[model samples]
Target: MPRARLHDVAEWTADGHRYRAELSAYLPRPALATGGPVLGTDVDLPSSWWADLREALAATAAVATTRTTVRQQWIDRHFTRLLGIPAPAIAWTTGHGDLHFANLTGPPLVICDWEGWGRIPVGFDAGLLHAYSLLRAGTAARIRRELAHVLDTPTGRAGELVALAQLLQVTARGGHPDLAPHLARHAERLTAMPVP
Candidate 1:
């Protein structure tokens, strides 16, 4: 499911020379799963799941550290730099910015929540989905496959970097109880991978 457009309007102000386009809001439908066992909310994810997540994280890190125009710099002058890569050119599409098991339900597994929807690089949503699936063992490959299928189109490939960017944001915000462990482990692995 993609993010729904709430409002879009263009405005002219000042002496008529200044113009602005404002896209108000967008979001997915409400969740049907409710309070029963939220997926991806566990801190101690399976090791196999971690392995698969590490692979994806490594790939994303490669792209982020290599291709981005914004270089990672320390908040204060530190001994390390956070490298950032540019998003690859691709067709833009509305997507459920946040996709997790908690947000899915029923037969088709409809995704909800559109607050994060916007123009992004390929595979952004799929990557997050794959990471969420990593909470359990034996699901990584399946999740990865599903992600690949969802993002296999040319437009998806071009937007892969956008997905990577979103992942990086999640990783950096280590306060989330559900994602803290995954992000910590991912950071370790990312630091270990050889920079291209």
Candidate 2:
């Protein structure tokens, strides 16, 4: 897998609006051919695609993150507001903070957008991916099957909780209305804490 390496950063003001620009090396792969700009549309992915993603997640989990990057606290707030108080000492792992389809490229399986990478809830990345796939039940089921080991664990459930809670938060702000109910249902089911 290859990432677009940042080579330069510059900030300037134009038309009274502050703007920052980043110059990065280009990768050959285009973004995934999914329908939405941020989330993946329904697609029939081969088993190998999920396997490649699993491999990448496994490799990424080993990476260490700085204090500035751990995302658990924000996740906790979301989880607690929805689920009951979260389990104590939930585990964390390093992975792309945004694992939606738009940030990933396929056939060869390349995850992109590194600036958003950081330590996240252990199963959060996979759960986020699965959450995005909720529009299509088959794709969501495949994610569950491929990531069952992670999403089924106590820590993984916390990860899924974060994903669900965050998604619900987004829906509350007028995003993904179609997905709002699905997110709430899953949150209730996974957290066993009843979503209001």
Candidate 3:
């Protein structure tokens, strides 16, 4: 959670549209990935980085907020339809709704992009990261291993299915063709149902 202090903020109307701009402290570290949200290749990260990430996520989860990242209605509608399984009871907690390699940085470990932070299923962040890491078996495995406490429960599995459904939907729209089959297989393994 290497967040910078916001020094200033401004808002204005431009041609019937509202716009905003903010000045904040700069982060010196570069993001872990620059290409995209999905990590297509393995990255060498130190063990300490993993520990720091776990701590940051835990700290985030402890914060109080009224915002929501994923709603219950969407879960109800998509869980069974997209995952081919009944939606399990979800345990909600604060999370970084979009937790991919692209949003993370460092041996210092900075989590960037705060817009989507809100209440989500307990393991949503870890699940989202795992989904992004699917292309790299080793990295994917490491994520599961490192985040086991968050990702090895019923609610966690539900959260992961939610993430998979999202990625699969992206595929349905002709995005991430290379990642589609892997997502399908992972879904199959999770629910024991064939996914296309």
Candidate 4:
């Protein structure tokens, strides 16, 4: 998988302000989406792209990381209220944490934006991509189909709900209003109960 390589980082105090800059290798391929993280329309991608994505995520999950993206306490505190169900025990794995369309590229799959990469619920990345694709039926279906191995298990379902709960919390803050209804509907399907 291709990715922008971080080369160096510098931080310094200039006058009364602090500044930081990072130098990274430029990636030539454009991201799969722009303007926002969610995909509003169906995108046409070849089967190979899907295969590559699956492989990439699998490889990422196999890595070990001490950084945490979704903590158990957060899930315990918010999951019941946000999901209308008790939080389940989650298995953890390394993931891209922010695996939406805007952070990925094609032709040859390249995952960008590594700042958020860390330990997360086992299916967090796949669930997040699936949630972002909810507005586009074709894309959503394709995600579910292509990532069924990870998205259709007990821990995976818990991870998906955790992902949806995170997005729903974001919606509460007036971000991605377009995704709220779809997310709520999907949450209902997952929990078999209306979200609070």
Off by over 4 Å in 3: 9-22
Runs of candidate 2 with Cα error greater than 4 angstroms are 2-22, 25-29, 33-40, 67-70, 84-88
Error of 1 at 100 (Å): 1.9
- Give the candidate number with the greatest TM-score: 4
Q: For model 3, how does the per-residue alpha-carbon lDDT over 1-196 read when each residue is reduced to its tens digit?
A: 6666678889999999988777777988778878888886787899999999999999999999999998889888777777777888888999999999999888688887776789998888998899888899999999999999988988887788888887788888899788888889989998899874
Candidate 4 — which pairs collide? none
The numbered model that scores best in lDDT is 4
Clashing pairs in 3: none
Listed in order, each prediction's TM-score against the native is 0.45, 0.82, 0.90, 0.92
Total residue pair clashes for candidate 4: 0
In candidate 3, clashing pairs total: 0
What RMSD, rounded to one decimal, does every model reach? 10.6, 3.3, 2.1, 2.4
Residues 48-88 of candidate 4: C-alpha lDDT, one tens digit per residue:
98898888888888888798988889899999989888898
What is the clash count for each candidate, in the order shown? Answer: 10, 0, 0, 0
Candidate 4, 60: how far from true, in Å?
1.0
lDDT of each: 0.43, 0.75, 0.86, 0.89
Worst 10 residues of 1 by lDDT: 74-83
Model 1, span 1-196: residue lDDT tens = 2223447767677875867665734334344334532243433334554344434433433332222222223111211222132323454334444556565533323334434344334455565555555555445455555456545666654344344344445455653456545533543443443212
What is the C-alpha local distance difference test score of candidate 4? 0.89
